[model samples]
Target chain A: MQSLTALLGLLNLIFFKPYNAIKMNHLNKISILFFLLLNLFFTACEKDNPTPGEDFGTFDLIFDNRVGDQAVSLVNADATEFPYTNNMGQSFNLTLLGYYISKIELAGPNGEYFADEISTGADAAQVKGFYHVLESDPNSQNIRLDRIPAGKYDQVTFTLGIDAETVQEGATGGVLDPAEGAWLWNWDAGYIAFGIEGRSPASPREADQFNPENGVQIHIGGWKDIAGNANMVNNVKRITLDFPSAVNIESRLSPNAHLEMDLLKVLDGHANNVDFSTTYAVHAPAKGKVFADNLAAAFSVDHVHQ
Target chain B: MHFSNLYSFSNSLFGIGLLALLLSSCTREKGIAPVAVAYEFAAPAEFPDPIYTFKNNPITKEGFLLGKRLFFDPILSADHTISCASCHIQSLAFADVPLHGVSVGVNGLSGTRNAPALANLAFKPEFFWDGGVTHLDFAPLNAIESEFEMGSCIEDVIEKLNAHPQYPSLFRQAFTTEKVTTPYLLYALAQFMNRMISDQSPYDQYLAGTAKLSEPEIRGMDLFQQHCASCHDGILFTDYSYRNNGLDSLAIDPGRARISAFAGDHGKFQVPSLRNVGVTAPYMHDARFRTLEAVLDHYSEGVVASPTLDMSLQRGDQLGIQLTDSEKAAIIAFLHTLTDRDFLNDPLFRRE
Candidate 1:
């Protein structure tokens, strides 16, 4: 009975003495719970109001894929009627068309710069700011950038594909995830920054699964610059476009920049007038360098809506 | 009366402890910090810093186990008939059996290149005969999607994994995600492969001063340093450079040229590590030589001429290395010391 008293005393000294010194009572318990609740409330409030007294708004980037003046209408691979014609008078119809956009930056006339948060990791939540714009998926074409400080933005810059640094970060999820329809070259081990697959009469009849008879697949991908290997190419292009007019981003107003990517410009650029017959099957980086060179001129900021 | 008072005091103390536990559990639900069971990954002292980006995917016990299951499971294959383990058996130092010169995949389709032994992969900057794959995470995609291998795309594999009863929960436990993604899948596999460090070989033990080599083995080691050390240098025994090694007269497979797209790289293949070379017979990228004797014989007298052939193999008009029968036997005896039995028989890598 004496030993039990000693044990109780020890327990009281170890666990309860600190609380006792603080005057533990019903009121203290109530106050502690209140403080925890206050912490939870403040954390919740912090997220909504990241920067107090600062005006912020959402900015939308609308990618409008077009074949010259007409909007891109994705045709079936087996479709016989070709809707688009190149400068070389070769008729072609696209079955699939897409490109990865990352490292977005917006510049204002007043020197206000906003660079989108870029991160790559195994977790889907950690992988951010990578937009895979596909012709088939209309929803993917619209990218909404939140928490933009209110400013009159005049220009926007973005990378056409996943950069070499991001590729070296190893496997990434979200839009960069290959399982979710990401164009990845497994053998070469890099993301295809831009890709176009379609049927053209000028293309030779190569009766393979990926390349059906008269099938044209132009995949621009390669993000490694090995030292002393001049033959190796980096096709990732940085595209900068000037907005037609300065658009105000305020809490009440969510401005949108509609950018048009013209397919005809890509095929008929001054650098290399793509002859679809011979240049139909472009799967390597060197093979697609000519097409990737035209990507900068292919994109143009058509309009901005405030 | 005093004892009763003490009991009540002790009861109140217990109540306070319960309250604290409840509050801590609430904080955990808020996701302040995730509790991960860490698995230690330490490189051998002689090895260089690992090339794998471990910061992106830290090694956890759960993640390693998930990866091990994936490695052994045939579900990654199209018809569910072939697994990574089907070609890469653990007993043979993760190399295919001798009969399988080139690994047979789904629907009994044979691969073109010989299945290389997987050991000390974390140290390698590149993978495969052509050295096309730059990252370990991206390596499996080739095997999974290749027509001559697993014959399944990453999309279908993810779909299949999501449909599995246990895989989704296992992945969730490993990666802390609601859905299994490609990165997590690759991370798990990489985690498993990275742990396959072969540092317990007799040669390694000799270097560590725990064991000693025989007279012939010592002589062979000296000869190896004199002849082979220029290419197969350091602890891993590979310089990781692309070389033709006089495999053929003409570039038939277009090996490294397929990746580099250069005529200079034609017929060139990455120098494979000689670790576990004793067990990984059916040698070279094409699996041309079935025995170590034949491999040495090729090095001695059978090196064919090629435009992109390694300069080391040619000494003016001489095409190959000069080695007698005794020297070849001694070299083979030394090569046997590289086999790490502990790594080959580790039950941790076995299917549970």
Candidate 2:
């Protein structure tokens, strides 16, 4: 916004001043030209203005993916190691699992809600609340929540997928930047709200005379819904998880929320247990809503440390 | 002569000479003095707010110039033989010149759709013939990574840019970051393309009550209002909605269906802005029409029937509007009035 003002001010100097000065006295014209040049010099120097830092508390949100009691591992080089099995009796191995978490809200002691500011700028400078959680890297698992007021918070809530405004804003920088990977579904013009990719022998393609080890690529994404159409609901799922107990937070103390994601629940928690033989790959919103629902239901706050 | 008159004469000459110096300064490659002036992106009275996230990436002279350089530079391609300007030339209203049915890429491969014009793009909510890319900032990624186009990924382009002796510093000046991230690159390119506003046409003047259109052009305008206005509506000349437009019974490209993944969206393509329709040809998603005459002919009698065809185009069984030769001629004249010669020759937009 500051730059916009500078731009307008500069424009007024060039266009508005020149138009009026062209008809004015000679001395005035010469003085105005010098003044214009002087303004330009100052504007150039202002380009390097240092971004002021804000004083705020930070909170860490940690995500850990698991199956039953054992931690989920990436597929090995031999490709024969399958450690987890779903309720449908299909053994599978995960190659990738990632999703976006945004619009986080923390309920304070007196029922006051402390919300983290959503960075809308397309630059790394605007990064704050948004984070990408991937199972492959433990370092990437920790999402730093900034600008929280120093206070005691009880319940924590966050959306499983990106909000409508951020989706509509399109590709931004930092975690939301599309250049980081193929998370942004180019065709749909929306982010893959939840992604789970792996290989399963029980996949329908394996039985259909294709590769015996057919891959399971599940990308849940969609953001538009026609008013009358129930089937066309773009699967933009929002999940708000309450901690098993209230978390105590303070300015001096660094608090961490350790959350656990049970893959078993994603496949077998509901009555509609996913069978890899028939349902492995899902791209549409209506088809993805089932998985989105399952995935949203899978996360629980394991513990909170203050 | 009075003393004041002599001073005024000399002062006027000095002003002309100073203006020449300033313009020459703008054309310099580097070491040009930083001027406080910047290009303004004021939306015309008739136009809506720009779709670009200006609050995030503010417009600056250095930023716009960096974007312009990238737009014209072939370094963004794998072989360094093709730049964005290869397909979007300024003289042709930023559409591919010497029109090809589909744009050819690095290795002589061809794209699936015709290269659309890059005029008044800041107003568009979505982009591409299929409306696949939602933001103007994300649009370049499609072309950069396409095997049929630049044949270079963002990673490679970033490496090349960082390695370049000049680009790293230029990136720093445009965006305050030392390392060129994907967002800064996109933001810079967008800054250049978003400023490509083409609104000073004779039609715009007519709206502004500053210019008068000829009788034939007026008649063509009337015909346009009656027939083409529904789809090609608004001052930007597009509603930005995807429609079948009865282009094909069985679409070869699958158009909007590729994005929506629905059979109902098959054969649909985004309605392109006709701001510079006269110069930007051959037209359509496949470059099917070489001239405005051919485009008019398509609407008059060439619309094909399909299940996904826009209902508005269906008038009984026979598709398309009925137009005589005179009507076609007048419409063509009216389209010509939509051209703005000033934009074509704008020195600010030109490469240094």
Candidate 3:
């Protein structure tokens, strides 16, 4: 309680300069009163409060990968079974598919906002909020955000890939660690935020090992926007989804938002139609801008469970 | 008014005291006395502020030593035959030896570009001829993962480090981590590279007014400033800009274009620092020239024009800089002044 008071005093010193011999007007007095009340309210919420509204609970985000209406299933690299077709009618099978999701935010109709803590550092423990959701890894799909205040949340926002600002923070561990399955482009010094690789009969036989004969690999990753250089494109996409229904989060009740990312929408969206025959290999950022433009229409909140 | 001023002054003093107390308390909790920092990165007064993110990876004695060990250890290679030290030798100002123009990597594979001398790297904004890597921490990754260089993945290197008897403990002591991770590994290497500050050369002494240059050397310095200093500018040398210096009419490598994906950037490569140019030969990205004389000759007579040729090199119809034999010789004399013998033979940088 004393520490809280000291913190409030420090805030007063910073915001108001209370130590200075300045005249306090009516507006200043009212604002100070409002600020103190707000501080007290927040302090009360932080403590072990029995208040119903001030209670905190967990919020889970479950990403479900899909191809149009059907759920996704991983196949072998050289599998002949072509399950999905794009707008171009080019059939393809997924050998690998994954994307990095970070900077999560939950919003409500009311003034309740919960932003997941985002930090980047060399320490694996300190690096948080970034999630690498791969079709191969079942455990990586579900992200649980704790310490969310009890509220009725109806919207969620997240960045599809790591931004240039975060990338410039230098080397980071955990999911961002290149040594530990992180899709890092060492030559360009950035992460391959979104990637899908498979083989299509439409795709031509190439000498490149990464994009082999009839192999379709589209990696959307560019996080730098050099001024006046239109060629250097930043393909990192920010996605916001409205929950089908408002879900309540309380001490007793935890909410889960199920989001489905359709592969068909990304490949055959209104912005760009990706033909596997000609547009099979995309390894650079400028090449991935069209696919990144289709990302906003690709994701939707399927449902919410309280 | 006087009383108020006194009160504010006392308040600030109290704040400083509080901060000092907190700092001391932190050290006390760690149970370690305040020791003189041996590995602190001190930028020379004449050099520009370092572009490296030293805040993320601060130089410590343990960390720098660990980095030095990793640098010298060939365990980072695929077959454990090549290390960072393999290409970057300490004697030749951390550049490859003269014989191996393009240093051989794992399994006798040679890279396309010459291994440039490693000095004042902390001041450099980017690495390599392509200038793709933005941070010093990410520079080693290319060498480690490149097909011709270390020919090993970072995952394998980390695994090798974890399994090693000394590496894990050394990493723990350096970074205070339980396990060997990529960031910590990169941090250690960065610590060592950041300490390679070449600021004690004769030219540096000339700048500091402690040493005098010979008549030819002084004339060479004047000529260098008139002709070369535009591209290779300032104290650290090299303006850190990518340019096509008329190296080839048709760029086989497609140098900077490989990274920028622009036709205009084709045949462009980073203008390397001339800090230790005398010892670090053969010169240029492809290691085309064998001697300083040959390099100057290329500048004077052998310049091949291209679309993306540097504007400074193209004087109307003329392709390269005009220089006489005496002028070239004078510039060579001045270039020799940049070779810092103290840095080349520094005991701290030498592998134990």
Candidate 4:
């Protein structure tokens, strides 16, 4: 009985120690916090598609815009050789390089705006600024979209140049932000529906100098209304394409030279009929219409992504 | 006999231990001081939600400070002379001042394009007037790498930052890493530009019921709504779409068409936002019109018909809408209301 009393007393002392109780409480709190931290670490978005870095996948767009060679303008032919015999007796150099294509739309063979939930794509918005194609694209810096939904499409429609609404939105949208050297309508003022600048001294202004001033910047736009006119049907031109069948359009589509703009011929009818009385002048209305219409009609189905 | 003495010592020990633990936790309870996050936008309710969502990069005091440092750092340039602020001045509402219409670059070389104001940029979908850059984070590379601008590559900017002692720590604190990158560099600059929301103008006040529009202003608004609103829609004053407004429908630049490489895309360009048109004179793509009167004349008697001309313009009866002289004055008065004076005087945007 004496031994039993001793054991019971020892047990009471061990169980009732305040230091042990405090230690146990501290340990429990630590474990809970550890678990919470572990959960957070695991749940954090730590996955990288490849390298965890600042860049997402890039959209490398290679405009086979070279296919534009099919279009032959009298002043600027679709091919490389000069296509003009002006009053100066010298053939104007014809470099068939094109301009900015702000937006694009696709239409089915039936003349309907291509729309489908299965295969989707955001409006292919360009990263604003002037871009050029070298003799060869090194990193395959062709046209790369953020990503489009996978599906079969009948046709693709797109805008060859800037649209009217975008013209007034300023540097926020469209292809005319000062950052993007695409719109240089500073010649007479206002926005240039089409801008063509190159080295040609035979024309007005110095050829070879990259001058925001004093250079020949042939901006051929302003399609909404001619300042004082109504229903001008400005630069909004339409081109329809019909696909052979449901074509897989999971990749970027570039219709080479099939989409052509002869930079030289843009002003073929301008110098003679341009009215420079005011601070702002423009190409003859009828001639501007013909150029825009013919250019719009040039874009058709080059091929289908099957 | 010693029980009282033992109790006194043990009680004292427990009391001191408890106080220490409690005090340590209380010291940390202030929670990082919730650093001040003042946007100082002075924005208006009428404007659309800002495009700078602060996604991935949250708006913190450290972030703003880091961005401000980058803005003034010459390290962004090739030779390290020009920062973004060199061309984009504060007094001119972030626009390049002087008569050249172009911004000066490294070696005093001037750029080919006009230096537009970076005001109200958070509302824009694209950056330049041509609408080439869709995302704000990447816009700097263009000017930085432009032969005439800063003339540096994105990789070069990163290299320069590594050499600076203050910048490394600043970047680490703001981005949570010791590493610097293009997106980080751009993200910081974009944050500064995005926060440049200059909407507090007389027009904003009139729209918000705090002020009233004058009769001329009201008349101008009506005329603008009928004639100009089709293209310059919404409070931002632009529909954010590309157009060929019949400026010169030649085959020249083919504005937006070059990006797409399609024929129908020819002769198209982006419309500009008209928020501070009065202060940002030399209007249009080329800074052509010296005054609002010139632009009004272009609309009243300057329109030339082309196939691509917007159909809405055709509805004005005659070839174009012939505005009376009174109507022109009213429109100009309304456009003047868009100027935001407070933005021009903000000290935060100024070089400290």
Candidate 5:
């Protein structure tokens, strides 16, 4: 949708005719015709379909982030309840844990592929093409994708972080809204696709660093074309999960895909053996790539409740 | 196959081209023009893509004029005694005069850091001495709220503008909004400042092959390239990187370190562009050097060693650029070539 400011400007230009009145007059007529055609087209299409779910079933994309068995909960200024320790032997407290999940494409057993269309809120308030799996918000974690072709699906492939387009252009509303204050890293000029800001006792500066009193923030994002000779890298990552067993989807019904995202893997599961003492804050792109790669490896399809 | 058929085909092709051009031009003409003066933001052929995204806040003639008016008005401050122009004068290339080591604000309140020159800001990735503010739109917020500076709240400024008889109408003409918003206000400011580009220096003319440099100036250019071009690189004259140039062994202020929260970043500051270095006297973040000669002397003999000092400035046991008196004079002559008089005198940017 065009911004209100742009629409007002266009209206002002139309009312206060410039030197090129003939051109403006022609533009006005063209714009009217265009809107008329657009209105008619949508109305006709909606009339023909009537109900979108007649041929297909709705599916839920459930993201459960955890540290081993325990569910991840972001605490506000109280970091003493530290329950997790990595291979580096550092007692870390996670104050914030959230990442963007997008571009989900599900493949059928017989080679039928369906791309999950991202829709926000309820059907009435739905906006398409953008999805964010915010860990703190239960509503955001339970993503409802509508109109998946009714059939058995074997594989599900999706990006772990925000798409390159959203990373660069930035979004105005929904999960990507600047006001949401979760994803964007204004200093780096890109979206923090995978963010985990907290503190740990293993930091060289402070022993009780994770104790809310001394918090260290780690914001990971660098979606550039190339990692310049500088210390950062392109940290945006894509992850794919294939189901162990095929799940059947009946027509006009709802199904849920139970997915698990392990937080312990962010440090120990990947090739980069990160030491909390030296690598606690990974804001730069190159340093952030280690966490990004590990987070991509953390997702797995636990089960599919058909 | 026939001559008549070929003639009709060519005529049709020409007609299509004309129609495409007209349609494109029509789309370009939106609202009242943002500026009365016909200035367009075009990066020099040699420069990199500007950090400011024109897509978000497109420059317009009306927007530029409104920003210009707002910039000069003292209503932005708590007391009606100072504006941006009070510290940044046009004659001094938008930098404070020699009297102020650091610029004085409303009620003769003094600031910590010297007011830097305001030119070629669109090309800069970050703003201020420490590279604290990343976006050009948000840079003014720091100055406006600073206790020693304007000391006025943004919400108060907005309320004042809304009450002003002429400003609300001017804002409506520029950005066709029902009421003024902070983002729109920032967009207007960005439009005005982004066009404050200084690309017409004698050095720039030399690069464009439009003017010739004198013998001493030519020699000075070579010397500058060898010694100074690493940090102050490219046509806009800055790499926009933060570095500790070894100004003081113990920094009076921990510069970039305060923003980044890294011990290694201590004493580091954003490399200031030398575009109008001749007019923007009292060099460096502290404004300790009054003249360009003093600045050159500092580099030659007065650099203090520090833990986070830039490796480029370090030479064996000593710190700072080594230069003879004649070489220093020649380098100063070359620095003078960077003065863009046309930009400094541009009436469009003036308070009037």
Candidate 6:
């Protein structure tokens, strides 16, 4: 009964205006403390609420080739140990495995390709030299886009090779320029499209650990038939990012997040075949398509953090 | 006394007003009106569509002025003595004056191949006699940086441009980028060259039915249709495909093979477009011929027998296509029709 009466009295004091409530001894001090507590509660709520362009609200569509986490990879679709080799004695371990990802589009929920792709690479000075070298050391690459507009992009679409229209017609700056080496042909007029390299003990080429004699130089590029190559011009490559929850393009994605990609699947293909003498070479349209499809899947949304 | 003073004051005010109006009228007449320059480039109506339609880069008064400044500015050269016009002279359809088989640049230094004239460049798919540089915008780099030609690096050229007081703003106005890089500069150069489209020749007028080919010219056209049209396809004139036209089966220079590194591509050279073939003479990569008759003689029976000689050239190449004196005259007449007297003297391409 005393507690009930005390609660009623406290409620009455709260309902009353401060001047009236602060009537008893020490009443003024108690009112001041109550107001301070109310202010802190509202401030905390405002701080927690996030909006577009806020620090927490962000989306970085990352691309990666998982391939056994760049450590030990599977060969011939078999659960082989790390650093495994495929049938034609093809092995793994890459240093700078990178190439130009010219055009990219993120798929919307309703399956529309939205193209807002752009490039940020080596400075004008660096691009002018080294026509044959690709720069993919550690974590410097990944079409890291400018803070994109805030919205949930359901699916992502991207092209594998350079757009012929952009290349043939001409672009004065960016990756397409010959001086950059991203798109280069020393003795002719074509471009080196895709590149993937690693430490392959399986390759007879890199056997000389001391002197470096034989190592498989698997370089695949040229103007392939656009009609079939999925990485070709005008092809809309849609990869769905079926998030369990909502995603925000402008907010809610984190940085320093790793999107592990699996390149073994890209090469091995879905047929469960990895004969790789001529078959594993992947020089045909079907191989290009397989590479593109598997590469798209490898870009599944990873954990987001600082 | 008051009335007289007021009258004098009124008269003075009127005098001041008249002087102000007269001053304003004089200033208006002398003021510069921003040079309202007019310009346009057109392809022949009857001809096939142009390959280079000035899409992103158009021919504007400012753009043309920028091109003209760069063309004349020796700042483009390494030593700053030779401009592009040094080799590509205006009077000769913008082709090098055939001093020898190849062109001589800075200090009379000789390069590998002859510099072809800049005519109907907009229609050309491949550039150079051997069809090397893929994009037209990037061609200036080869010339600017070639050790034999201008002998300047692109970065060096950019540095020179950046130092200039007026060029930065001028380049910015032409291309939106503040920093004038090689590609933008090359693009501007190409715009200038590509716009050098010359289709207003008498032959064009004849095709339009506005004029008629002369009797000799008609006969020349017939012969050209019979012999030349197979290789020199249409408006821009050449098929633009690389072929071994019996220049040499095993050329020391290794024409197209230098790029392709292919076995079969030993002496293959891009078919030369014969648009302004008359004035832009001393033809072929080597510029071996001194006259049109010499060129005709080569086609008539001088083509060498080689493993890679064009099958069409089996009959002596030039030896078989040999023209009799009258036949030569007829063929020469047809070649003359291709001369665009109007383009040679086009005021737009002329120096301001």
Q: Which candidate wins on lDDT?
A: 3
Model 2 residue B268 lDDT?
87
Residue lDDT tens for model 2, A137-231: 78778877766665666677887776557766655777776666637765456678778878887875542332335767777887664332222
Q: Which candidate wins on DockQ? A: 1
- Write one digit per residue (lDDT tens) for candidate 3, span B1-352: 1011111222235675455545545544254443222367889999999878888998887788899999999998999999899989888999999988898999898889999899999998778998887788999999999989999999999999999988999999999999999999999999999999899889999999999999999999999999999999999779888899998899998887877788899998989999988999999999989999999999999889889999999888998999999999999999999999878876668786
Q: Model 2 lDDT vs. the true structure?
A: 0.76
What is the C-alpha lDDT profile of model 5 across A1-306, one tens digit per residue? 224334544665565455464656777767656755654555455533433234576678798988777888877655566677777776777777877777788877787567976543211124365666776678988878666776778788887666545443322334554433436544444467777767677765443533344455566676654222132356777777888777665564677799998888877764865677777656665566667777767888888887
lDDT digits (tens) for residues B1-352 of candidate 6: 1011111122235675455445444544344321211334466576667666366556554566677678777888899987888778776788888665577767668887878888877666667765655556656766776767888766688789988999989888877667776556766776677667677778888888899988989988888889888888877678876667666647766676554445466687888877678888788777778888988888776777677677777753243465788888788878878888756765556665
Q: Which structure is stronger by TM-score: 1 or 2?
A: 1
In model 2, residue pairs whose N, Cα or C atoms come closer than 3 Å (at least 3 residues apart or on different chains), thus clashing, are A40-B36
lDDT of 4 at A5: 41
- Candidate 4: C-alpha RMSD to true structure equals 22.8
Q: Write the per-residue lDDT of candidate 4 for residues A1-306, one digit (tens) a residue.
A: 334444544554464445454566766656546655654454353343222222222122334432124333323222245444333343344332345444544443433343212111111133333233221222322433443333434655555455544443222212233333334332212244443332233444432434422222343554443232232346545444554554443333422212223332333333432221211213322334544555554444444433
- lDDT (Cα, tens digit) per residue for candidate 5, span B1-352: 1011111222235675455445544544355332223445777677788767777666776787788888888888888777878888877889989889798887788998999989878787677887655567766766766768888766677778888998889888887765665556666777888888788789889999999999999999999999999988877778878888878999988787755556788898888999899988888899988898998888889888989989988979988999999999999999999999878876667675
Put down candidate 1 lDDT per residue, B103-203, tens digits, no spaces. Answer: 99988899999998998898898889998888899999999999899999999999999999999999999988899889989999999999888898999
Clashing pairs in 3: none
Name the fnat for model 3: 0.85
Report the error of model 1 at residue B334, Å.
Answer: 2.0
| Docking class for candidate 2 | incorrect
Ranking by TM-score: 3, 1, 2, 6, 5, 4
TM per candidate:
0.84, 0.80, 0.84, 0.49, 0.63, 0.63
Better of 3 and 5 by DockQ: 3
Tell me the docking grade of candidate 4: incorrect
Lowest-sum lDDT 10-residue window in model 3 chain B: B1-10
From the highest lDDT down, the ranking of the candidates is 3, 1, 2, 5, 6, 4
Model 3 earns a TM-score of 0.84
Model 2 lDDT at residue B91:
84
